[model samples]
Target: MDAYDLHSGNGNNLSGYANAQIDGIISALAVSADPAERARLLAEAAPVLWDEMPTLPLYRQQRTLLMSTKMYAVSRNPTRWGAGWNMDRWALAR
Candidate 1:
């Protein structure tokens, strides 16, 4: 909920939304060491976040890759570096 957090928005929250409850929840999550408490805080925040709809994106990021079945050692990097990150290790199938 970084986008929803008032302090953590980092310009990602296009709507400029702010919620005290959400902010408190996120703050608690940050310092919370107990797994159960963290889980509860997250669970409590879900409904509030959904109902708020602070900044819903019009499009989700989708990564697409096309590879031949005959190809082997194809790198499937999912980051912005792209799939050819390990090109040096790539080789064709026998």
Candidate 2:
């Protein structure tokens, strides 16, 4: 809902093309049944976002994951909790 509000074309005239594409994507996603069609729509919008660059990065963060050779199940997420977040699902390699 937040995203829907963020790029809504209800009354605010933020920008033309970006607003239309963004709101279109968000609204369409609510009822989009075909995953492949969704992918195509997402792909269609990516370049427009790239051209606009809504978020300009200023810095970076670094993280490391350490695992033993025998431990085979680990997930690494740079943006969220790291490799141990889902330790409940981890298993040995055998």
lDDT tens readout by residue for model 1, 22-66: 878877877889999988998998898788776675876566778
Looking at model 1, residue 74 earns an lDDT score of: 83
Best by lDDT: 1
TM-score against truth, every candidate? 0.50, 0.47
Q: Scored by CA lDDT, what does every candidate get?
A: 0.72, 0.65
Name model 1 segments beyond 4 Å from true: 1-12, 57-94
91, model 1: CA deviation in Å? 24
Clashing pairs in 1: none
List, residue by residue over 1-94, the lDDT tens digit for candidate 2.
Answer: 1234436464433333346777778678668989998888778867876887654447655668888888866768634445677788788887
What are the candidates' C-alpha RMSDs?
5.5, 6.6
For candidate 1, the per-residue lDDT at 69 reads 87
Error of 1 at 94 (Å): 29
